[model samples]
Target: MHRRRELVGWATVGVVLCALAIPWFLWGSSTVVFGLPLWLWWHVGWMVLASAVFWLFARRAWGLGVETADSSERASATASVGDGGGSR
Candidate 1:
């Protein structure tokens, strides 16, 4: 039941994102704010960005382990990071 609810919510979000991007991609120039041209790319970018963030959040909550990087890769990144030691 919980999974279904999360899926439905995500699906609704994805649909809304697509709706925004598709129409903007098709006819975006007319929609403007303060004389700035509202291009389709802008909408597409936002939709994509939002989806990525939401996916990460949901994956974490669902324990899906769907991060942008592999575990080993993340480990390597951490290994290469600055020291945890604080100033004396």
Candidate 2:
């Protein structure tokens, strides 16, 4: 259930990411803003938004779908690092 919920969350984010990948509403429009075409501004703003979304995901949910080592291995790795030994 938890994994399903996470997947759904990611799916929604993915939809938002893809749906705005192109500024379809600005196509064939002659609008300009601050000496730049509106579509170019849309792309610049979209990139900023995408970067923010990715930054938040990296900070909060980076391992959502990643397979990780089991507890014993994680414990050993931590112990090794704690003792100033590199995990081999």
Candidate 3:
């Protein structure tokens, strides 16, 4: 779970960096792809790529079923440890 969360974080950073940086790099391009300017196509491509990355992150890291199980285990462990009821 921790590794999956880390992967999701890295993927999110990648998507954000690509969205912000790629267009700036292509700011003066006059090339065309599929009838759009190259810079415009670059933005569109990143949008699609970001969507896929987010979907993968969601599927792997956001599943409620696993979280519930982990939470329940933690709750049981905490209950077994109990508060010390200090300083009587």
Candidate 4:
């Protein structure tokens, strides 16, 4: 329900929708899914799916809290700048 989870959920939906609706070349064969062509699914489907699932699991494990590493890194970097807005 937070920004991070919301973004990931939207991303998962977007990728899956794209895979089910878009078509592309693959070994000169037309790969299909749900009678439609798979574009993102061809290479990133499983990975994204796994990531989505993992994130969902992680969210639950962490009591549905947003403790992503990137957010922490960003916060630390900002704090280190001390509000001077580092310009280098």
Stretches of candidate 1 off by over 4 Å are 22-36, 40-48, 54-58, 61-88
Q: Residue 25 error for model 4, in Å?
A: 15
- What's the TM-score of each model vs. the native? 0.40, 0.69, 0.52, 0.25
C-alpha lDDT score of every prediction, in listed order = 0.56, 0.73, 0.64, 0.55
Candidate 3, residue 6: lDDT: 64
lDDT tens digits, residue span 1-88, model 4: 2345655765676576566443344645666887655654555666666577668656644422355645544665666744332322
> Distance from true position, residue 9, model 1, in Å?
0.6
Q: State the weakest 10-residue window (summed lDDT) of model 1.
A: 63-72
Write candidate 1's Cα lDDT for 1-88 as tens digits: 3434655776676688667665544463576655655675576578778878678766654432243234534554567753422211
- For candidate 2, write residues 1-88 as lDDT tens digits: 4444776898799798889878998789879899998898888999899999999988866766564434434645656644322322
For model 1 the TM-score comes to: 0.40
Itemize residue pairs with steric clashes in candidate 4.
Answer: none
User: What TM-score number comes out for model 4?
Assistant: 0.25
Evaluate model 4: give its lDDT: 0.55
CA lDDT of 85 in candidate 3? Answer: 24
Error of 1 at 23 (Å): 5.6
**Which has the better lDDT: candidate 1, or candidate 4?**
1
